[model samples]
Target chain A: ELQKQFKQQEEHAGSLQASMNTTQEEITQLRHKHTMVKAAIQEAKWKQANLTRRVLKLVSAQEIERKRGVPLDQTEEQ
Target chain B: LMRQAAHVNAWDQLLQQGHDQVQQLRLTLNNVKTDQSRLQAELDFIQGQQQELEQLIEPLEAAAASTTPAQHQG
Candidate 1:
């Protein structure tokens, strides 16, 4: 009876160890995915900043042309 | 009998540690998944904003390009 108990305990430990290994591997993959998502976010933010700058420049140019007495319709027609 | 008890205690300890590690790893995975989704949402927002900004700029750019050559010629 003692031997059987010991064998069962050992099997339980083995199963737990296997579960831990699988969980650790999953964590590693999750970390990789997190890193990749973070990088993509960074790239998206950079693109957003560039587009914002372009929009500002264009808006400011239009403002300056308006101030210089250029008709908006004339510019649009050309 | 004492030796067998000691062996059982050791196995129990090992099993408990494994369970704890697995639990902790699962929590970490959940947090990472949440973060991934949040970042994805933010990226999507920025891309949407970029599209809007580009749309706003398109006509301005065309107008600027159209005017510049006329100004130069005049």
Candidate 2:
């Protein structure tokens, strides 16, 4: 009976060790993926800002042309 | 006629990649928040699970002009 109990304890300990190993692996991968997502978010932010500034510059140039073409004085006289 | 009507340039094409930024946000949000049918894996460091996620996600959701969809699931 004592031998049987020792055998059962060994099996339980083995399974617990395996569980811990797998959980550790999971946590490491979790951190890796978390870092990746954060990096992607940061890149998206800068890219968006860069693209937006370019767009705004284009709009500003168009506004200058419009103001030049449509003089405020001419409209006021009319 | 198409050439005059269409102002296609390398700069314009480069700026068009901004579409990928939108897709990246969507993918990141989905990665953090699972939808439907089990299989939800959350960061263990944060306490109160979904509550912590709400705090983390609020700014992004606010920027997108969309309110939080999942109030509970923990």
DockQ score of each predicted structure, in the order shown: 0.61, 0.01
User: How well is each residue in B1-74 modelled by candidate 1, as lDDT tens digits?
Assistant: 99888878887787778778778878877887787788778778877877887787788789888996786676
Please list the residue runs of candidate 2 whose C-alpha ends up more than 4 Å from where it truly belongs after superposition.
A72-78, B1-74
Best model per lDDT: 1
Model 1 Cα RMSD, 1 decimal: 4.6
User: What tens-digit string does per-residue lDDT give for candidate 1 at A1-78?
Assistant: 778877888788788778878877877887787788778878877887888788788778767766765675678789
Interface RMSD of every predicted model, in angstroms: 1.6, 26.8
Residue A43 lDDT in candidate 1: 81
Q: Name the weakest run of 10 consecutive residues (lDDT summed) in model 2 chain B.
A: B36-45
- Per-candidate Cα lDDT values, in order, are 0.79, 0.49
Prediction-by-prediction clash tally:
0, 0
Q: Could you give the fnat of all candidates in order?
A: 0.86, 0.00
